[model samples]
Target: MIINKILNVDDYYYDVFMAISESLTGFSVNELQSTGLAETYYQHILNQIEMATFIDFLNVSKNVLDNAENKDQLKNAISSQIMDNPATQQIAQSVITLWYLGTWEGAYVNDRSYKEGLVWNVMHAHPPGAKQPGFKSWETKPVNSNS
Candidate 1:
C-alpha cells in the first residue's frame, strides 16, 4: 500500500524519507526491532519536525525538483502542514537526498552532525582528545515546589 502511494506521489516526500533512513542507517525493519531503537528514534523525529530550519529546507527541496506540475496541488496542501524542526531536519536531509540522488547517502553538502545539536550541547560533550572532561557528571535534579 505504501509503495503504491509512493509510486503515485510524483512529489515523493515519504519515499525520500524511507530511502534516506535506509541509506544512512543501513538497517532493515527487523534489525530496528531487534535493537529496540524504533521508539527512541520515533521520538527524535517528532522533535526535529518541530524546527523552523528543517521545515524550510524540506519545502525548498521538494519544490526545487518538481517540474511535472503533478505535485503542485499536494505540495500546496502539505505546505501549511509543514513543520520546521531541528529534530526532523536530519531526516529531511535524507528525504531531499533521495529526491535528488537516486540513492540516499547521509545528508547533502550540509553535513549535519549529531555532535552539534541539543543532545551534545545540553549534555556538554567534550571535544575529541580533550585534555579534561567537557561536563561534570551529575545526579538527577531535585524537584522544586515553585509550581
Candidate 2:
C-alpha cells in the first residue's frame, strides 16, 4: 500500500513506524501494511496532530527508530523516544494496543467493519456478522475433510 505523505510527515515516518511496530509486536511490516493496520491506528493519531510540536516529536521519534543498530536497539530507541513526554507515551501505548488488539479503545466503535482487522486472520474465523456457517454445520465435519 502506498502511504502518501501527510503535510510535513513523509513516507519516512511510515517506514519508521513500521519498523518500530514490527520490533514491538513481532509482526512483519508487510503483514501490518497488508491489513491496513497503520491506516486504522497510526492514521488516527496523525489525524489528531495539528501542531508543530507533535510533528517535531514524530520526526524525532522516527529518527531514533531509523538509526537503531538492531531490533533490540530499535525497540529501546522508540521506547526512549516515547518516554520523553506524556503525550508521546500515550501515542506509543495506543499504537501498541492497536497492533495487538486490532482496535483503538479510545473510540466508541472500533469494529473491523471493513474486514481488515488482525483478529479475523488470527482466529481463523470470519467477523461476527460475516460468513457465518449454516445451522448445525459446526457439529459435523466438512465433507472434504472426511478422509
Candidate 3:
C-alpha cells in the first residue's frame, strides 16, 4: 500500500522557498532576507495555495536548482519547468510579483512589504511616502544612476 505524505510548514520548506525565491527574483539570498519579509512572504504563499500545490511547486523548484549546472541552464530549467508548466506558472509569477511589487493577487501584503519592495531597489528609489530618501534628496542624481 502507498501512503500519501503530508507536508507542513517548517525550516526545510522555508529554505526551499527562499532558494526558489532567490532564483525567481534574481536577488541574492542576503538581499532578499534583508527585507525582513521572507518568512512573511512564505506564509503568505501558503495561505494563498493548498499545501499539496505548494509542495509540488517547491519540489520542481528544488529539482531545477539541484540539477542545473550553470546560470544559463538554471534560467532555462526555470523557464521550462516552473514558468511554462501550467501547474506552477501562476504561483511562480505570484512569487516574483510579491518580491518586486509587494502585492499578491493585486493587493499589497503590508506596509513593510511596500517599504521593502525590490522594485524600489531596482529603480534606485524609495517607495513614495513609504520612505523619504532625505530632505531635498530629489535635487541630486541617484547615487548609482548611469546618467
Candidate 4:
C-alpha cells in the first residue's frame, strides 16, 4: 500500500482495475490478487513504459475513474480512452487477456512464459507437449482409424 501511496495511486487506481477486470472477466478481485495476476500485470505495464511514466499513467487513470458518476460512466470513460490511445490500450487489454487466458502476449516480459501462464490453472489441464495430461488420458476416448 505504501508503494501505491508513494505513486499517488493509493485509492482508486487498483480499485478501478479490479472493477473493470471483474466486470469484464467475471473473476473476483481476491482470485486475481491471490493468483498474483495484479502483480504480473503491473510488472508487464512497467516493462512497456518507464516507472515514472507508468506511475503517472496510473494516477491519471485513477483520476478519470474517480470523476465518473456511475458504473456505466466509468466503463465508458475507460473504454473510450483505451480505444483512443493505442499504446495504453494495448497495456490495458494485455492485463484483461492475461487474467482470462493466462498468457502474456507482450514482446518483452520474458519472466512470464507459457509454462508460468494461468491457463494451466484455469483449464486444469497440462501444458501441451510440455507434460502429459496423465496416465492414458490421451487415449481416454476411442481412437480414429482413418489415418
Candidate 5:
C-alpha cells in the first residue's frame, strides 16, 4: 500500500508510534530507540497498510497510553484496545514481530534489523553469523548462565 503521507521525525504520530511500541513490546523507550530501527519500522508499517487504518491504529494506541495510569492498567488496555480489536490486531502483531524477529509478514526488514532483533537479546544470544561473540567465545560459559 502506498502511504499518502510520510511522517517526519518530529511528527506527532511518530511519537505516538514509539510510545505505543514501548507499551506493546514490554520495552522501555530507551531500549526501543537503542535499536535505531523504530522509525524504520514505523515507516514500514505505513508502507504496508492504508494510511487510514494506520491512523486508526495509532489513535487507539494513543488513547490507551493516555488513559492507563499503571503498568497493569496499560497492559489490560493494550490487550483490550489493540491486541483484541480486529482493526488493530494484525498491525499490533506485526509491530511485535518486527521488534522481536525483525521481520514483518515473514520478510526480514533489513540486515541491520535482523542483527538487531530483540529476540536475540531476550534469548541472551546473537543472530547466527552476525554479531559474533568473538573467537571461540562459546567455549566459555555465558555471563549470566545460572550454571
Candidate 6:
C-alpha cells in the first residue's frame, strides 16, 4: 500500500525500492499515496545515515543486497538515493557539478564512442555545469594499438 503511494508520488521513478521504503519507514498506505516519493525516500535515507557510516553506505550498497537482513535495510537505501527535494536535491546535484560527464547521455567523447544517458533519466537532472561526463561517463580514450 505505502509502496503503491510512493510509486504514485515518485511518478514511478523508483523501482522496487519503494517496497523497502514502505517496510522500513512504516509509511501508511494512505501516507505513502499522499506524499511525494522524494519526500518519503529522502526521509528514509536520512534514517539509514544515522544507522550506517560512509564506508557502510558504500560497502552495504554494493554488498547488502546479497544479505537477507541487510537486504531489508538496503531497500530503504536505494529509495533514499532517489530523493529530489530542494535541500537534499542539492546533495544529488553536487555530484553532477563535480562530474558532469557522469550525467551526460548525449555527450560523447572524441567523435564516436559509448552512448551517454540523460541526466534525469535515472535520478534528477544534475545541476548545470561544464559538459562533463554523461550519466555513468561513457567517454573513454581511444584504444591504443601500439603497446
Q: Please list the residue runs of candidate 6 whose C-alpha ends up more than 4 Å from where it truly belongs after superposition.
A: 1-13, 28-30, 37-147
For every model shown, the clashing-pair count is 9, 0, 0, 0, 0, 13
lDDT of 5 by residue, 11-121 (tens): 678888888887778887779889989888888888988999999999888888888888899899999989899989999999899999999989999889999999988
Off by over 4 Å in 4: 1-26, 106-147
User: TM-score: which is higher, 3 or 5?
Assistant: 5
Q: With candidate 2 superimposed using the best TM-score fit, by how many Å does residue 131's alpha carbon deviate from the native?
A: 6.1
User: Compared with the true structure, what per-residue lDDT tens digits does model 6 show for residues 1-147?
Assistant: 122333334533242333433433444334443433334333433443443342333332333333435545555544554233343334333323212232222333222112122222234333345334476554544344253
Per-prediction TM-score, please?
0.26, 0.59, 0.88, 0.53, 0.89, 0.21
What would the TM-score be for candidate 4 when compared with the true structure? 0.53
What's the C-alpha lDDT at position 136 in model 6?
Answer: 58
Top lDDT model: 3
**Cα lDDT tens digits for candidate 4, 17-121:** 555555445565566666554655655656666766655656656655567787787677777765357746665667666675566564424434454455666
Assess the local accuracy of residue 91 in candidate 6 as a C-alpha lDDT between 0 and 100: 36
Per-residue lDDT for 1-147 in model 1, tens only? 022233333534444333334333344334333433333343344454555554455444444333224345534433333225454444555543333332235432222222222223224453344223435433424244253
Which runs of model 1 end up more than 4 angstroms from their true locations? 1-19, 48-147
Model 3, range 43-126, lDDT digits (tens) per residue?
888898899999999888888888988889989999999999999999999999999999999998988999999999999888
- The superposed Cα distance between candidate 4 and the true structure at residue 72, in angstroms, equals 0.8
Error of 1 at 108 (Å): 24
Per-residue lDDT, model 6, residue 51, is 31
